[model samples]
Target: MACYTKVEKETCIACGTCGAIAPEVFEYDDSGFSQSVLDNNKGVQAVPEEVAEDVEEAYEGCPSGSIKLNDTPFKPKTPVSS
Candidate 1:
């Protein structure tokens, strides 16, 4: 089975960016928190790279910076000096 997880409600500010960016991968639950719907059969039904990027963008663009994208591998990028 693939690893599947949802965003942390405590960390999610309900910006709806996840649903806007990748509805197929995320949706609002009963509490209106973003939840992951990627089901793992043999492996996790991976979100497309573009969708993944969008999710990351949502995370970064969150006004409260409270969005959390779980089950996705994230590597910190090296800072680029202007």
Candidate 2:
């Protein structure tokens, strides 16, 4: 079971609600908008199992409708070996 999340950054109001609910999964960018902790995902990131509930709460609490929560399978990129 995976909880894939994405934030529509263009419309993000930087409310910080998601961050406040799940700091480990969401963070604020330089512009102060809510973004996924994992980068280079075009706003798509997998919420840790431990914080899945928090993400869900954030999604519900988001007033800008920027938070998108999904249960579909998420395949993160494999880091290249140095």
Best by TM-score: 2
Residue pairs in clash, model 1: none
lDDT of 2 by residue, 5-59 (tens): 8787888988778888888878887777777876433535566788888888999
In Å, residue 12's CA in model 1 sits off its true spot by: 2.0
Off by over 4 Å in 1: 1-5, 39-45, 69-82
Per-model CA lDDT versus the true structure: 0.60, 0.77
- For all predicted structures, in order, the TM-scores are 0.54, 0.76
The clash tally of candidate 1 reads 0
Give a tens-digit lDDT track for model 1, residues 1-82: 1223346667777878777876767777788777666642112355566566766666666676655454744343378999
Error of 2 at 19 (Å): 0.8
lDDT (0-100) at residue 3 of candidate 1? 29
Residue 13 displacement in candidate 1 (angstroms): 2.4
